[model samples]
Target: MPADPAVVDTDCCIVGGGPAGMMAGLLLARAGVRVVVLEKHGDFLRDFRGDTVHPSTMQAMADLGLLDDFLKLPHTEVRALSGQVGDEVVHLADFNGLKTAAPFIALMPQWDFLDFLADAARRYPTFDLRMNARAEGVIERDGRVAGVRAATPDGQMEVRARLVIAADGRRSLLRDAAGLPVEDLGAPIDVLWMRLSRRPADDPEAPLGRASAGRMFVTIPREGYYQCGYVAAKGGFEVIKAAGIEAFRRDVAQAAPMLADRVGELASFDDVHLLTVAVDRLTRWSKPGLLCIGDAAHAMSPVGGVGINLAVQDAVAAANILHDAFALDDAALDERALAVQRRRLPPTKAMQSLQVLIQNRLIGAALSGRPLKAPAVMKLFERFPRLRRIPARVLGLGFRLERVTSPDAFSG
Candidate 1:
């Protein structure tokens, strides 16, 4: 059947050119499916977002043959992840032994990561990259998704596809149009981020670690500089700004003294930006002929550094399932094709729930100086060698397909 006169047709039309959307497009396009990516921003790289790609994502990138390219970019390997419980710093390395080939976390700017994916997508003839295109609403027919209506500079245009993927971040226009329920797990604090010039003593190989004094602080290594972010109490940005730059510098210096020295060189407040961390989980991820990936489906809080890695995992899982369904001549345009959601939702929901429980219930109370200690829980984490392996395998990389299919299947 020919597409409507007012519509352009493709095998897959992906909304948003972020990591998940781009990855899905690349995977489908490689499988000889016609794919189009619609992005609202003219450029791919955006700032003030999650950037750490965990070991699992790195493993996925390696499978895609993009590992070397990623490593060539300015990045740091996080040898250890630490958490501050009261005045004590507990290293997480003991929780789970690093099982991934790339055991360390790669700290790179998200803009650079997206740019790399975009460049890779350009190599495939089956992929079409469309920028500055905003998806105003989805085109539905008989209670099923058919296509999307987008606003371009030229005017409104309709795009028809066998599959419509929503990867447009937390506040997705497509998800809203589909009437999906989004649950926001509010954060107790926000972050003020700044790019600090690298100190002569600073080592790109091993950047200074994250520290939390009732709030979190991290120094992520980026190209030629370091991305330093500080977690502030709710409504704390105004207080920091009102304290003046000098006072703010003093406070940062007191928290992470080494970072303070570097921050002192900052010329102005314009160098710093604020970001709010809110956890969002979608009630439904798919309907007939449509699916949502990445932040659109499940937006995890940054507490465990799982957001981007999980987004990449979602992309890989979607690609794998779609590749199989399309090959089997299954109706890729129906809810059955959304079976990937069945496979994805379980783990995504479980992890997101765990994050909320830990960050809000446990960590939140502890950060308030309440001296909330769960020694039994901590001892369990320390004693069980498998506890760390579970998270490392689950979050640091992709889900264990075989184990997820049958938990006891791995026993024999």
Candidate 2:
């Protein structure tokens, strides 16, 4: 027989401490609701997680009075976006025109962002963050979720709560355990991620990607290096590996000519990490006593790099909609928790719809060795500088930008 689980109680038990989980925990704890966030990893030092904090996110941080402190962290700001299309460099977006406090995308490592949020949230009396605690299954009572069973370094533990939220990335174990169905929107390409030292002279801020005939190369400027990606067609890594790592490096250099000099830094295949691209969404984002947000609700492609922003927005929305219930001391949180899904589902579907459209219409074509002819509509960005605001607004603000609307108990 298995050992008895140690039981702990909380108002809200959140699984998987990512963008959504951390943001929600902070906001709820601020509202004086007991929150327990479980992070499987002891530290948030993973590479190649969501790195772009969109202007919408920055604006939210500003609204929460954390902008100044947030900016103190080491980061790169992208005020404008540019890409090489068919041997020509074109300005894609101009964030300087956006109507927000911070009108640029802050490219900070996901680990740093998570760490900062966790530190800030720890200030709240109701915040309980347990690192190295991996949620194994959902605990249910009377056909409704009541808590979570998690595995830790020491032993199995049970956290009983009024509600459980799953923010555990795309492959959410909690979501699977909850039996929520997912819709696969499909992805045409996978990315091989690696790093190359950045030159002091390189353009520190560049657009999302540099794509050409059969290649899409993305290089993000970090503190001292370039985090690069080599995108390939679905299930295409075998062919790439067979051709050898040198050939792959040469192809990446060819796509993004600016990195030609440092291509040799990718000395072996071990240096490259393959990220299988997936675009999907859950059929239903909520259940009787459980809710799923962020990548657990929907997984986005790398097209706009807006997944993290959307996930954070989901957190804000969740806190806004459900905090009142907890604040009112409601033990039966079923209907209100479902309201979170009702409020956020539209925006989640809208973003995923747009991503699927772009993946099918643009990225898929690019990955298939087809040359992308710049549409005449794009000429407006070049001709009328003000027109750049269109895409900048979309990329920065997204389909729906959520703000912190819940009352903070600390303010009282």
Candidate 3:
């Protein structure tokens, strides 16, 4: 039988319907560019991922006019942040003097935030969302990306577009097809995530806390249940589970005595899930008509909790350049459009590198009970109240007063 004709053609074809892809499609579609988004998963949001939206990300949502909706969702307002240094809790409130509208971090499940973005994208007439379509490979013609080849249930098909975006995530098939280089900075620890029912009389103390020890526990407030995450060294899952449910409960109790009473409430091991934290940085973000955004470009370690926020920033930057690129009268398929990719790649790379350094080298050791300090770390909190603001900005909470061109521009 003859092959079916191209199902649909669009100006921009975005692979992956996660935050980065959806945000890019929303902006492009709103700008009147015909966009088609392909998502491998039927549903977008997955459980037990980064749920905290930094102050800067909230500001980004505000710019997109979704701030009110985002704020109205079931989330915990982290009035004060805290960290651990060998069983000692250091309140982050001291750094709250930094200049930002939402000085406090908001903890919401990542699934809800993604759902909101997808719903907003549906409002645009030019947006075409296709779920259960997995991108298998890229189609290249004359040393440039032509479009993509995706697999459907019945058969394989081709999608032709002027521009193709690989927001398919860290294990991006499109990135692999393009033969892009990926550097995986191994993670020193892994996280075991679980949800627990909050006691009716549980103390309502901001819904967020961390305990310092060989193991770390973070409790975040959800609508009805509390999202709890426990951190342990790599390859510790079997050891932890072998200790049995009672011993595991005791471990949590030792970490956060307040949550000890609630530990016994856990019904089964099925309630908990484990995730390995791996940091990755792409050697190149683009080639001709193809561009990689979000986790596809740079996957940061979960320590700073900046992955989603950085992905949002990349979407905005790409949209800005794409809008300009498509507006040109001679905007035919060529190397000229690659400029957008070039402009955004550097900052993403720099941020990812810094994340690896902080998560694996400095902060990782501290979180793991090692006693080593750099003078700069002490001065960051003591001498400069402004330095704390840098992270807020990096996480997409607010903008710096200076016209910063690079990530290093704000470093002290």
Candidate 4:
């Protein structure tokens, strides 16, 4: 017979060490709460994850007084956003006018961001991060979730906590284990991501997006390479693959001529990674002893690269609400979990709605080969520079900006 799994206990057990899980763990740990964060992966080196850290998230860092240190990490800042529609280059949004400590969107690798948060969290004596531990399911007791069952290389281990948080990505195993229902908002585009060398003579634009003919392409300038994304119809990757690598390169070149020379870099389909876009949210975000946050609660479409920011916001809200709830009994603890969903659901819905609108009207139409031009809205933004701040505020900040309300127990 197999040996029984080891058991550990904590105040809060967070599954998935992404932006949400790590941020929540850090914040709650700062409040003197015992937090055990479980990351399935041994390392945070996953590529092509959402890297846009907007001003709102930075503001939360400022609230925690970690902004100066966090900014020291290697990252690029984008002050404005624009897209090419047919023959005209339409300036979509500008972040320069936003009234915040960090107005621009900071583009850093997701792994670096997670590592920074983990490092900060580790400073708290109550924070315990266990990597290479994948959560398999929730541990139920007395008709309520009381902990997590995770698989580690050593063997199986159970973490019993006052409350359990599921921050696993869109395909969350714990959310399913909790029997939470999801409302599929649907997505119409999938993105193929690749990198191409950025030469000194290349365009210096921070991020460049293009939609015309029958394709859509975007390139975010990185330190030494351009992170490129090619958008296609939903479930259309097979068709793209069947067309062969040369045809794929031709399509990429046609979509964004700036990368025409680098198109050859994508020698085969293996060189490109496909992100199966999904827009969805859990109809009910919490059950008795468990709460769902980030992609686990709502999977976002990569429209504005807002997934990371949204997930971070969810963590902030969760920490703000639930930091002290551990002192309460089981019933009050359940209410605190529901409170996180209540406070975060509005912004989540608003962002998802905006994503769906763009996916349907813009991405879907472009993929259908509809003749494209700068939309009237884009034209207006270009015509009147001040109008750009509207999108800047919405995208660069967010609908409901969360503040770091969890008290620092270690602060003198």
User: Which candidate wins on lDDT?
Assistant: 4
lDDT of 3 at 406: 19
Q: Candidates sorted by TM-score, descending order?
A: 4, 2, 1, 3
User: Better model by lDDT, 1 or 3?
Assistant: 1
Q: Give one digit per residue, the lDDT tens place, for model 4 in 337-356.
A: 89998899999999999999
List model 2 lDDT by residue over 1-412, tens digit each. Answer: 9889888999999998899999999999988899999999999999878799999888878888999999999998889887765666667799998889899999999999999999989999999999999999999999888899999988999999988999999999999999999999888788888898887575655645776777778778877788888878889988999999888888987887777888899888888888999999888888877999999999988878898998999999989888878645444477787777788888777877878887776667678788776556666678888888888898899878887888788985
Deviating ranges (above 4 Å) for candidate 1: 1-6, 84-87, 94-99, 200-213, 266-268, 324-332, 370-395, 398-412
TM-score of each: 0.84, 0.96, 0.83, 0.99
The CA lDDT at 225 in model 4 is 92
The TM-score measured for candidate 2 stands at 0.96
Tell me which residue pairs clash in candidate 4: none
| lDDT for each candidate structure | 0.71, 0.86, 0.70, 0.92
The 10-residue segment of model 4 with minimum total lDDT is 197-206
Give the Å shift of residue 114 in candidate 1: 2.1
Residue 179 lDDT in candidate 3: 84
Give residue 406's lDDT in candidate 4 (0 to 100). Answer: 92
Name the weakest run of 10 consecutive residues (lDDT summed) in model 1: 402-411
Best prediction by TM-score: 4
lDDT preference between candidates 2 and 4, better one: 4
